[model samples]
Target: MMAATDALAGVLTQMTGPWPVSAAARELAAAGVPVFPCVPGGKRPLTEHGFHDATTDPGQVEAWWRTHPDANLAVPTGATSGMVVVDVDVHAPTDGYEAFERAYRAGLVSRWAFLVSTPSGGMHAYYPATPDRAQRSWQAARPGVDFRGDGGYILLPPSMVSTNGATVGYRVRQINTGPSATLDSDRLRDFLDPRPTPPPTTSDDVQRSADVSRLATWVAARGEGERNRGLFWAACRLAENGVPAPDALDVLTAAASQSGLGEREITTTVRSAYRTTQPQARPSSTVQGSPRAADGWFARDATVRTSAPGRRLS
Candidate 1:
């Protein structure tokens, strides 16, 4: 299995030039890696079930490509592919290179097998998957970094994208020859987007505190179709327990952001929850001196996107 995985890794990292999408798909399948077709020039899956339709069967691979001959190539990440990816996004006003560099300097993301330059001038650092357990995918919107693990898929080299009226490919940037290392995704995420340290509970806080930390963590893990509902539910719980509106915002803003909810959406949902549950409580105009305000991490607006459970990143 290890040898097969190495060979599969080679199929991606060793490609020095463009290969026909179908050919690349076949090669990956022949290497024991399951593959699926994505919309040409885009990341959307062409099949009915997206990445869930990935298969190692040569017949299925051939059929899919025959139907969508110009389709892009993608593979399910994590244990299925024996690999994972650290996606460093580079966009206007947000660049993950610095955050990735910080992780590298801290000895957190050093063992990548290869690096793929994304069409959007971003990067994908491929690493070997940890054998003992599953590392689920996560998004740290503020840092502009995303983890492609158990519930995600990534387009491969030579897969082209239409960017700014010019076509660009997912090109291999560098391949490591030395020993490769696995990334501690959870630790890396915490470092990139550290949660605010809760302040010491005063008499006021004692009356309102109700396992805020655990509730925040749960909020952060909520996925699409449930993010708004989850945030509202958590906020209601906190409000019912006397957690102040300002305090609830401080705790949940970052968590909801991590789950891919935008700043406006988070604030609205949380405020609505508090208003619905605490009709008599006065609403504060601002959250002065809150832990989140002290850290200034939760104030920045970040666009977050998350994969559904057992689903690919969309």
Candidate 2:
């Protein structure tokens, strides 16, 4: 029997993976990569949003390909594909390509899973968009190199480019498909998109966490009449830094209850605190009798989208 890699190679050969644009689009869409159309036989976007229009929905993919069967394919770079592409161009006369070589020789760019050879004699080195790397596109940060990242898109494989009846299509240059190949490479990330300063280390995190914990402890020790006022003050402090209301309620409610407040009292106090914090979201003074009213309050505030899991960013 053939080796697993050989088997996958054989399977790839049977399908039009990087061949006809429609087939390439279908395959990529199925693999969770959002695909959108560039102009048929050209490179401009067919949709208004360009790469933002990329969707993994099979039906949308089918519908798009159905309408523009010959359209060129493009996928959003960065987190959309869970990747960023380091584009090194041989066609350009700039020193960017040379800069890439220097960086590579310096033992940078040591991580990448696969690469695509572009029609213009350039290459797109694919690497995962590691969460901490802060991936974003750059043009000529070196010379002939570009980063196809947060706001960039890449021509999908098998999408043909032709000039004056001469055709040149992107083709796969390397394929391992192993876990190492598929995983994001932090080293390669540093080479392409180095942060000016190191990311914040654990010291700040540890201090903030300790501070919050101490505050929680103090709130939990408040006595009966002061329970609501204490909880409200604590919730406001948490909200000042954009902590999610639900989380603040969870922490402070536990604190309030230990101070002898009832469930209804705790809920009302927290809700009022949140409303006062977000005065724009405040409703009329009258109370509604809907059974789901409390739930509605929570849901309305659920619009707070978190940057980190426990905290929202303003």
Candidate 3:
């Protein structure tokens, strides 16, 4: 049976030039399979022609570079002074490419950067590196930064310049010089780490909390299943702000009325049933009365009112 990489090789082999390969394409290449740079011709066979002279221009190559001046071209082999190349495999959806470009531009302004788009929409960003070991040492200190000298990652043939043509070995056109003239490799490392930070609680969060509090109070006046349903609604509301389900349930039970139903019963019922049920049983058109206007003892009393203050329920 053909392996996954082999299957991808077949797909990449079929595309024409002026195309970008996604991250999946890179994997296939890394696995020793050749993928042609797709252009007008259907799948030209991969050869040394792919990485041929970096000084020559193929048809459509100049126009492609003009359109995407910020895009990087991969340096398949050899070391260039003052450039760092990072091999990145972009998966499908290519959602994060622009962000990566922004970050790269910020840190390496005035320098050339290259990104070879893989078959699956991922890219490799290449930058010029300082030739001195000391300067290069600082560049390598940053994780994910490559100096191209250490067998870091091979640029394969059939890779198109990001903007246009499919002919390989074409020199990458450098358009705008990056604004970041110096490489602060340490800061760059921190900037790229994927750790999450908690957002500061805002006035909107306070308002949401107040809304949930009022809801809990209204639910306390209701008996049994209705109270459980209210608790579930409040919990769901809190969840929109990243509150965990169990914690929201605890808060709901604590705020519920002590006399009408046991906290455990209400919480359990909410967890098992109310959480899964629709907010309202009947269609909005069929519902005759609001909870505030219903002909009930609780509805009549001011202290047991069910109406949302300063808001309408439609």
Candidate 4:
């Protein structure tokens, strides 16, 4: 198979003017680049399996276009096409160009093979794929930027899309004359949308975590008749106090087992409690800051005196 750059160059040579979608699809396939047909004037794939059905065989390419001659041209991203794209979206009041510009300035997105102007006034920056590892596709919706890599596809030039009641083609904007480089998709995404910093853990948070152990011990000490009901009530308190279902199950499972509860029964009871009370659960922040809120949740059942119940700390 031809390298992606050479194949791209071959496709570019054939794109002198407004070429037909069938011819474009044929040229791409002939260049060793897999091609597929999409809905006319749109990005949605027409084939049953979508991008997975993309093929480089000239015969298959011809059959696809013959059936849907006006269909838009699409190519799979990442290793399938040996290329990846940074899609800069242009939804009104949420344009991604500013975020992209920031990434460019930070040296996070400096090496692009080419640029394509999308019908929606956005841009697509193409890059060579890193051969050593796969880069999965992802989107930073808040920043309005998306990465098209493995498991994603993009429309090619001369393929028109309906935008704002007007039809426009995905036209070539610029070609890189110098060395083209692969993109660090992970770095780019982190730069565009940094994860929030976690709040500092407090003393109360420490107490809350320790309290869970005590609560479990209390559940294990429950007498025969009260075993199931005690487990249910403990699970409900954990849920209302914002303890994640998994953690609650982990702590409660062993304790409930000690009280003769079966594995299935433990899981069912814990899950039921989470489903019933989690929606109305107080936020961790509220529970952590207010001693009364934490105390209130534990006070709901004062019978577990020896090992007092408490809100979960995250």
TM-score of each: 0.64, 0.52, 0.26, 0.62
The digit string of per-residue lDDT tens for model 2 on 1-314 reads 11322332333344443367787677667766678888765555566545667887889888888998888887776665666677765322343445565555465543454556566555666666665455655444324456666656677566777744567766665543443222234454456545567457698777867777888898877764576788888877877766655556546644554454433355467667778887664423312111211223211112212122122112
User: Tens-digit lDDT track for model 4 on 1-314?
Assistant: 12785577557655767799898888888878888888897766677556778899999999988999899998888888899999876544455666776686577766666677676666788888988787877666556677877767788888998766789888776555556778889888778877666579899888988889889889988766797899999999888777767567657865665564544466677777776787553222101011122223211111111111121211
In the range 1-314, model 1's lDDT, one tens digit per residue, is 24434666578654656588899889889888899888788776676555667899999999999999999998877887778889887534455776776787687887666667677667787788888778777666567677877757788877897877789888765555556777788888889988777888798775444478789899988877798999999999988887666657657865675565544467678888988997775443321111111222122221122222232212
Q: Record all residue pairs in model 2 with backbone atoms less than 3 Å apart, i.e. clashing.
A: 18-158, 96-143, 96-144
**lDDT: which candidate is best?**
1
Question: How far off is residue 29 in model 2, in Å?
Answer: 1.2
Question: Each candidate's root-mean-square deviation in Å?
Answer: 11.3, 21.3, 26.1, 20.5
Please identify model 3 stretches exceeding 4 Å from their true place.
1-82, 92-99, 102-110, 113-115, 134-149, 156-184, 194-314
* Lowest-sum lDDT 10-residue window in model 4: 283-292
Residue 84 accuracy (lDDT) in model 4: 90
Q: What stretches of model 1 exceed 4 Å from their correct place? A: 1-5, 197-314
Which 10 residues in a row give candidate 3 its minimum summed lDDT? 281-290
As a whole number from 0 to 100, the lDDT of residue 92 in candidate 1 is: 40
Colliding residue pairs in candidate 1: none
